[model samples]
Target chain A: MPKLSYLKALHRALRDEMDRDESVFVLGEDMNFALTNTTSGFLDRFGADRVLEMPLSEQGFTNFATGAALAGRRPVVEFQIPFLLLLVFEQITNQANKFLLMSGGQRSVPVTYLMPAGGHRPGWGAQHSDQPYSLFAHMGVKTVLPATPTDAYGLLTTAIRDDDPVVVIGPLACLGVREDVDHADLVPVPLGKGRIHRAGTDVTLVATGHLVHEAIAVADDLAGDISVEVFDPRTVYPFDWDLLAESVGRTGRLVVADDTNRFSGLGAEVLATAAEELPLRVPPKRVSRPDGAVVGAAPELDAVLQPTREQIADAVRSVLKESGWGA
Target chain B: MSVLDEVPATEADSAVPDSAALYRTIRFIRRFEERAVELVKAGEIRSGIHPCIGQEAVAAGAVATLDADDVVLSSHRGHGHLLAKGCDPARLMAELAGRATGIDRGRGGSFHPSDFSANVFNATGTVGHGAAIAAGIGWAAATAGSPRVVLSFFGDGAVSQGALLEGFNLAALWRLPVVYVCENNGYATTLPAGAAIAGTVVGRGEAFGIPSSSVDGQDAETVYAAVREAVVRARSGGGPSLLEMRTYRYHGHHTFELKTRLRYREQSEVDSWLGRDPLLIQAARVAEDERARVDAEVEARLDEVVRFAVASPYPDPATATDHLHADGLRPRPGSAR
Candidate 1:
């Protein structure tokens, strides 16, 4: 079994897809130079025609990818900075996302907006730190936030091949996480499917993106008193609520860990939907950054702004206590 | 059926538009816009259209030079572009009327209709954004080893958008087969070009090292010659070119202006542009018998077009949000389920 890090998984998925489909081309700033290491050595392998190096024109290139996709060429656009997504949100959300509907399904834009260092890298201030998968998801764009190496490779591979626009966010924090992998186990993960990493009869901890790792660790630490189930809904939009309902029904408790703003974030949507539709013994709990959070430059500030494992552990016990069950 | 004059196989593949066929195209767009305006007033067209009434030659002349298979990216005032590019008049009228028989199946109204048969990929209402999409299509065609050139049409206002200039840079850098036509129609909504643009229009294209020229948009032949040269250059892998068409619209920016009664341009300035009307300019070039025949035929054809548009059924409400995703994922209902 080879140890596959999350970064390698993302890089490998892009390399493999381009190899599989000649129509799959990459365009972004400094792609030939491999600024994000995702397209490292791509220029030499695919030649200058396939790997396009764009100028520092985000909006132009974003819509350019949309146009290319309209002409039957699959474009995987990689943006190094997460905030650049905000800059070109209109191109993705308004243009590429709506083309299929607006064109009456006559044309489909199969462009993959790949954000390599999504959400808060170390020392990068407020401008660069944002996990905006919720933004794309809200606009009905298929959004993928993978928590593990295998899931990263699977989900991203699926995104590039999709006939519509998809946003694949490789969370900066999950890049270093590694796992032993059997190459046969590496496969395309279907969107809107939840993976139950650990099963239990007690509370169900539904975590998103990089926070899924923190959630699993918290479940292990509280193994003595509470039986916790850790579930990761890798793709946020078109969420697998049926899978979520079954887990919550078994546990009779629900808690969400998310790496976004407290208000209207992924965690809020999970709890809101569960509270409105799913069976729950007690009120659902959510651990997320404060409302409209702006992560500062310092590491301590980043940690303070991020959801922690201790917070997830406490939320699980508190939900049980609220239910008047043994905490 | 297509009411507009579609060139014959011989003329379609010709390097330039035949004078008579070109006159019919300009005349067709002129009559089509007039009928659309009437439909807007009759309450059939819920969203009043942007009438490119006087700027017909730019669409007719420019589109005449290209092959029927080449792609086009249009703007908000795009009926002229679409009609000249060979979209069925009845379907286009139905699209304006928000009918199920529209080119976009009523998903996109007059503002965003895309006719794949005509090679007119959907119009972007956002100003200047179509340029980038055109460049992208151009790049894709070149990459696929296809000789298809892309034509992007926009107004004077689009020149200032950062994305449009960036689009220029990309097309010039990659030597993509795209022709950008700027209809400098004196004003954008209400602001005059003198107040809106900083430097000259051709300078924007020249700054990117693209072959840039300004043409008299009122004469159909002048526009045809300029676009034909650009198309020839693009088809031969000579990169992109920009042509600034000095044209003016006879009507207000949109039909909404009919109610607002806004007074921006002087009456004298309005009368001056009306004198050089592109339709009349081309009408003179054709034989009197031919011109009168096209006129009678176009008016009679538009009557049926209007009937088809108003009589077409509206789409079912159940499918209002259909075709949103390729994978067929539905959003949760708005009300409590």
Candidate 2:
């Protein structure tokens, strides 16, 4: 079996889709040079026509992708930074997303907005570090944040093939993560399906994107004293609530580790949903950044703002204590 | 190809700009808008429309230059644009009436209707965003080796929007087959164009290296001649051209103005624009008998349009979410739990 890195998985997905469908092409800044590495070797393999280099006009090119999609072409647009997503938010949400409904289903905008370096990078400051996947999910856009290399490969492929516009956020923290996999086993991961990384009876730790790795580590660290189930909801918008319910039902305990801000974040939603529907023996806990958090210049300050494995372990312990198991 | 080569000498091609046809189009738009206004007053149409009564010639002339296969991205005030592009007036009227038989199944209403079957891709409520979308469509068509040119229509207000200018840059850089038509109606709602836009409308296109020009938007013949040249340039891979049509709106921005009586422009200014009415200008070019026939024909057609709109049923509330997603995935029912 070959080792596949998360970034390489993204590259493989783009290469494979372009080979499979002639209509699939990429347009973004520095695509020719593959500045993001997800588009690495794409220019040579797919030619300049398909791997287009765009000027620094995010709004212009964003809507351009929508127009191309309307004309029966699948365009994968790569954004270098997370804030660019905010810049073109209206172009994607108001223009691209609204077209299908506004046209009365006469057309579909099959454009993929790929954020290769989404979420925090050490000293990248406030603008560069944002996990805004929850924003898209709230807006009803199909949003995916794959936690593993294989899941990255699968979700990116699925986003391209999907008829409606989708936003695929490739967490910067997960880009270096690698896994052993057979190339033949790489397949499309359906949106809205949750993957239980590890099954346990004590507590269910629901995670997203790079946070799944943190949850798995916490689960391993607490293995002697507690059993933990790691549930990864690969797609955030069409969430696998059924699977989540089943997991929480068995464990009767829930803790969510999300990278986004605490207020109205994915973690909050998971806790709310589980509390409302699932049978929880203990009160749910959430490990997430504080309200309106911005990772500052200092490494120490930035370290505390992001959800850490220690925080997840603490949240688990708190839930256990609340259920009188740790007494 | 030279400008002369752009206009085919074939009789069918020449007849497209025939005097009577232009008159009928302008007359139809004029009467249709008047009838729609009456419907608005009668409460048949819920929202008051942004009538393009004075600027009918711009749409009629520019759309006539396009082939049936060509696509158009229109603005909020797009009823005339759709009619000129060959949309069924009855269906459009029904759309205004929020009827199930409307072009958008009554989902889009007056502000955001789209008639894909007529190649009128969409009418965006966002002022200048359509320009970027149009450029994308043009790029797609060019990449596919199709000669189809895309026309993006906006008002003078859109000239100042940064996104629209960004679109101009891309269109010029890629030589995308697009014609950006800016109808300078001298007002952006209550604000005058001079107060809102700096430099000039065509200057924005010129700064982007697009071949920009000004045309008489009041005359259908002049507008046709100017837009025909731009369409030719685009089809022959000359990239995009920006044409600033100096026109005006005879009515208020929306029908609500009929009650509010906002005084932005003087009544004299309104009278002056009305003097250059597109319907009257095109009517003069046709014979008196022909004009009368077109008038009577348009009157009868509008009667049928209104009748159809009034008789059409409203869409069932259960189907309100029908076209929300292409995958037909309805939203999950609310959970009390």
Residue pairs whose backbone atoms clash in candidate 2: none
**Tens-digit lDDT string for candidate 1 (B63-181):** 88888789989998999899888899899999999999888888878888899999999899789998899999999899888999999999999998998998999999999999999
lDDT of 2 by residue, B1-337 (tens): 1111222334124534766777787888888999999999999999889999999999988888888789999888999999988788999999998999998888778898888877888888889988989998999999899999999999999988989998999999999999999999999999999999889998999998999999999999899888888998999999999999999999899999999999999989899888998888998899999888878978888888899999999999888778767788666656663
Residue B230 of model 2 has an lDDT of 90
- Number of the top candidate by TM-score? 1
Which portions of model 1 show Cα errors greater than 4 Å? A324-327, B4-6, B12-16
Lowest lDDT block of 10, candidate 2 chain B: B1-10
- State residue B123's C-alpha deviation in candidate 2, in Å: 1.4
TM-score to true structure, per model: 0.98, 0.97
lDDT per residue (tens digit) for residues A261-302 in model 2: 999999988988877788988788999989989889777889
